[model samples]
Target: MQYSQLGRTGATVSRLVLGTMNFGPHTAEDDAFAIMDRALEQGVTFFDTANVYGGKEHRGWTEEIVGRWLARSGRREEIVLATKVFGEMGPGRNDRGLSALNIRRAVDASLRRLQTDHIDLYQMHHVDRSAPWDEIWQAMEVLVAQGKISYVGSSNFAGWHIAQASEAARARHGLGLVSEQSLYNLLSRHVELEVLPAAEHYGLGVIPWSPLAGGKLGGRSEKGVRRQNANTRFDSEGLNDQLGKWEEFCSERDLTPGQAALAWLLHRPGVLGPIIGPRTMEQLDSAIDAVDISLSDEDLAALDEIFPGPGGPAPEAYAW
Candidate 1:
């Protein structure tokens, strides 16, 4: 796998990050281990998880599984582990958010679950509007001093949120956010409006989640299969036409829809890599193959014609 620097940091990470969100819920422990083993063998050194990824019934279950794998495989040092905070982990009022109290408690809890002393990259799952930047940076500073977390990151944050947080870190002389995780797929390019540019300006790597657009770009869902599914935006005729065109384009180049979609993101600027949350070994294998699928200028132009982004970022996308 190709490697890239993690933001402006000296550390380098694999271009493909393995996401373990489905470890306990959708995939069994054995399969999860196998998938991780495959990932490491394929040189996918980055693994992303969260404190609240295992679903409502068994929160933190995914981390527990990862902890077990780490204990058995002894590959903890080989992976760049990332996990998130800000999800409700319990019934208590202090169980979530980016507050100093919660961050301290949550980091300890996550360490216990992951069987690791320090998180390589500790990410805030979402921006806490009520939490002040001073409070947030102070908490992060504490973690860095304690060696509990090496780097900080944010997920699902807007463009302005990134700017605000980075400026706060600079004020404190702390290493600002090293990455921003957002939902950026061929079908969903909303981050191009501002988030991508902000990350570029602040030297934050853009790690895109759901790069397959919930299996839509992967050609897994049949046409009209989810017409009644309220969660999907594919209920419209326009979206169906777009998907049809995308599928045909992928087929023409002898690529699976998933590979084509991933290849498209891999070539985009400011993108460190796209997170691939595979439930099975086959899926992991398929995702890794995308690293070798080269896209020509004409191929990229064709993709843009099919799934256009927000014209190029900020006012340029809207005004003069």
Candidate 2:
């Protein structure tokens, strides 16, 4: 697998991060273990999970599954495990958010559920506007000092949120956020407007979730169409047109749609890796093979023509 620095940090991580959102929910424990085994065999060491995953009935079920896998496989030392906070873990008012009290309780709960002593990367799942940066940074400081988490990160944050958080951490002489996970794909490139630029500016690695646009680019057009419910992006006619062109382009190059889509993300600037969440072993194998598929300048140009991004970041993309 290809490797990249985790933002400006000295740590090197696999270019493909295995995400466990489906664990204990769509995928049974046996299937989840098999997928993770295959991923590790293929040299994927980064694993991403969230405290809020594993369906509504079982809030931290995914982490529990992962913890079991880690204990059984004894692969904890080999993996750079990541999990997120700021999601409701209980019905209590303080069950969510980045408040100092919640963070303190949440981290301990996550650690217990994960069955690990420390989390490699602890990410804020979303921006908590009500929580001041100073409070957030102070809470993070406690985690860092206690060796509960190695690095901090953000997800689904606005560009200004990154800047503000980074500045706050710097003021406290902290490491700040080393990475930003955002929803970025060939079909969904809104992050190009500001988030990507902000991450680049702050020297934060960009780990893109939904890199395939929710399986639309996963090489199964019929399946994608069938799964297009009200909340899915595949319901739009314009997206269908783009998908047609995308499929045609991939077919011409003798590549699977998923492979081409992942290749495009692997080449994007400021991207450390794309988080691939597979529900089955076959899907995980297919995603791992994408690391070998490289896109040339002409191929990239063709992809741009099919699914154009924000024309190239911020004011230049609109005004100047």
Candidate 3:
């Protein structure tokens, strides 16, 4: 793939981030390794994981599998690795959150599981409403100074939360957040209302997760094979009609619905790329196809009519 700097940072990353949340949970270790090998071979050098992946029973299993892959593949330096914090990792009261102690402890644990000394990008999984942004930044600053993390990022944060964090970092003369991860897709454009604007203002790249709307845009569910994640969104009224129109439009353009959805995000102003969490190698191969899809202006308009966004941004989207 295509390459872009991670937001305004000097560092560069692939447009498609390989998400390993399914490793050891939905995918066998061998399959996970093979997918990773394929991902690297195909130029997908960014890998995203989390400390609390692999469900409650096996919280760090995904990281462990990735660690094994890194050790065996010896390709850690080739990847721009990202992982998250702020999820409950154990029963202890201090096991989670963005508190200084937890941030310190969490990064160490993640590094060990990932088999890497420094994380390319370390992100807070969610905004901790109770934690002071200064306290959080102070912890992140320590990591940066120690060379444990290259950049800081946020996930599932609103516009105001990003502003608050950025201002806090500014006061401390820190680099602040370099990226924002949100649940953005052709079908879900909530971030366009504010998150996208905020990230753009703060020079943060926006990475869209669930870019296929939980596989609703993957087309397999439309072919009589119902995927588990594709059914909920289809039960609603007019969705089938919309999806039918979508599939027809993609067919006319010789593109898969999945490719169309990803292409839509790729065209978005603030989006760097969409996260592709593939459980199988076939899925991995299919996702990479979106990178080459050249969506015309007419194609975007067609997609907009089928899956509308939250208008433009903020008051213009709501008022005048």
Candidate 4:
């Protein structure tokens, strides 16, 4: 596994970050533990999760499992742990958003649940449009000062919002966010509009989630016996969206759409890490295969011809 510095931060993380969104809901405890073990064995050191990922749970069981694994395996020091807050966690109105009180409460809860004294990278899951950047940044800055978190970051945040936070941090001389997590994939290149440029300009690392467009590029649905593979998240509703034009693109090139899609992301500049969720070893192998793929200029030209960007480096409001 190749490691890279996480943005301007000195911490080095693996290029492939293991995503724990599937841990408690879609994957069982034993399987999830095995996956983590294999991932660490293969040199993947980054693990990304959120407090609200498992159904409607306030604190997902995934973190608890991971905390236990860290204790049992005695490998906590070897990993770079990342988690997010700012999602709806319960019935109360205060259960969500980036309010200072909630930020304090959430990080404390996350630390307790993870069995850790500090979080390596604590991120706001989304930009709270109602809250000012100062409020959120101050809270995150407080966490860092209190030694509860090693670093701060934002996810699903736009360029303007990130800029505002950075400006706030600069004015206060506080630790600003060093990374931005957003959806980036061959099927969803929306981040190229503003987020990517902002990251580059601001010296922030871009750790993209959904690198495979939720398995649309996993190569499982390709024609022939591969289509029948059960290792994929191939439900009828999702499969409906996966068919037609996209399939035609894959067919014409004689490439599995999944491999082609991931290869495209790996080829992209300024991609710090990609969070890949694989349920089984075979699926994990397929995702790792992306590491070896090198797309040709001809391949990139064809992709550009298929899906054109919004053009040049300018901050545009994206749907993501």
Q: How does each model score on TM-score?
A: 0.97, 0.97, 0.97, 0.87
Global lDDT of each model? 0.93, 0.91, 0.91, 0.79
Per-residue lDDT over 192-234 for candidate 1, one digit per residue giving the tens place of the 0 to 100 score: 9999999999999999998888887877445646224334753
* TM match of model 1 to true structure: 0.97
Candidate 1 segments whose C-alpha is farther than 4 A from its true place: 220-230, 233-235
How would you order the candidates by lDDT, starting with the best? 1, 2, 3, 4
For model 3, residues 57-155, the per-residue Cα lDDT tens digits are: 999999999999999998889999999999999999999999999999999999999888999999999999888998999999999999999999999
TM match of model 4 to true structure: 0.87
Predicted candidate 2 versus true structure: per-residue lDDT over 220-259, tens digit per residue? 5454552343347645678767777888899999998888
Q: Which residue runs of candidate 4 sit more than 4 Å off their true CA positions?
A: 57-59, 220-256, 315-320
RMSD of each: 1.6, 1.4, 1.4, 4.4
Q: lDDT for model 3, on a 0 to 1 scale?
A: 0.91
Give a tens-digit lDDT track for model 4, residues 1-320: 77889888899998888999888888888888898999998888999989887776535677777877787888888998999999877677887999998888888878877888888999889999888778887788788889888988889988888888888888888768899999887656777878888888877889888876666555544354334434343345544454455567678777667666766776788888788887787667666666766778987877776656665455334333
Q: Return the top candidate by lDDT.
A: 1
Better of 3 and 4 by TM-score: 3
